[model samples]
Target: MFPSTEEGPEDDSAKHGGRVRTFPHERGNWATHVYLPYDAREEFMDLLDTLLFHAQTYVPRLVRMEAFHLSLSQSVVLRHHWIHPFVQALKDRMASCQRCVPRAPLCLSSPSPPRLPFLS
Candidate 1:
């Protein structure tokens, strides 16, 4: 997950260019990745809340996520200029594909094309 605020000097995240890097950094390059967004059902939200309540007892700072997704690709680098075109191309390809619908909560449990609401 990406955070807007700086991790501070005590945080070693700033060392070696960044906390971790898949490829060498370049001035105009940007990191990119793909994922399947999920819209949790009411049942899942309830379950998550119950889990969070118990988890907060141990880790009080734990924050609830507004949304989450299943990562489909590892981090990849792209030129800043290519960002928009790359997204548009991905959207075009996805628009042509058929959507999958599975009753199970996790989409990765399904075959080939994942069964997720956003992918549709």
Candidate 2:
């Protein structure tokens, strides 16, 4: 039998300075994730600007989001050889899912308190 070449979790943590890997590290493998992109309309931008104006008064370092998206899945590691097949399988799985298009104005309910360094 071939001896296991995979590194233990402790070794991974030591190599990466204790931060958890989104996916296990393996030769020829890459971390992959998927998300649904959000296309903000002009109205949404206006609302965002108004919110930022108010938010900045309390948190001076607050910044606007460069882009917005909703995550569809957690990160998964994929071997280089499996990339094409995995993408094709994902496409097939998504084909039958209903398309989601938001029509109403997005609303924020009970905004969470910001955990700014100054507040802490």
Candidate 3:
């Protein structure tokens, strides 16, 4: 009779809804994210609250964001050596920029469900 092999760690990918990590973990690399801040107004906040309330029927554990913002960049790997220079450059660019209000109107309704294969 053959003996059973040992397992190292329990794989709990479903704990995060089967989401995959974008970047591989390495010692000196850091994941950097850049985003634009969104300050929702009273009417917008009410609408967002209503939407979230409706969505919670399907996703009970969902919660509202204290600070909601649009992501400007995906997770990018930055070596430890480049962290300071990258932050300095970003700061310099942002220093001269005016308040950014999105030019387009917000679409409150989804036209159709997204075609992302993972959801299915």
Q: Write the per-residue lDDT of candidate 2 for residues 96-119, one digit (tens) a residue.
A: 888766777564442233211211
Best prediction by lDDT: 1
Local accuracy of candidate 3 as per-residue lDDT tens digits, 32-90 = 77766778889889998999999999999777767877765556778999889888877
Question: In model 3, what is the error at residue 79, expressed in angstroms?
Answer: 1.0
Instruction: Quote the positional error of residue 109 for candidate 2 in Å.
Output: 14
Better model by lDDT, 1 or 2? 1
List lDDT for all candidates, in order: 0.69, 0.68, 0.68
Any runs in candidate 2 off by more than 4 Å, and if so which? 1-27, 104-120
Q: Please, what are the lDDT tens digits per residue for candidate 1 over residues 20-95?
A: 5545656577877788898888988999999999999999867678887777665667899989987887788788
For residue 77, give model 2's deviation from the true position in Å: 2.8
> On a 0 to 100 scale, what is the lDDT of residue 1 in model 3?
28
Q: Count the backbone clashes (under 3 Å) in each candidate.
A: 0, 0, 0
Q: Which candidate is the best by TM-score?
A: 3
Off by over 4 Å in 3: 1-20, 92-100, 106-120
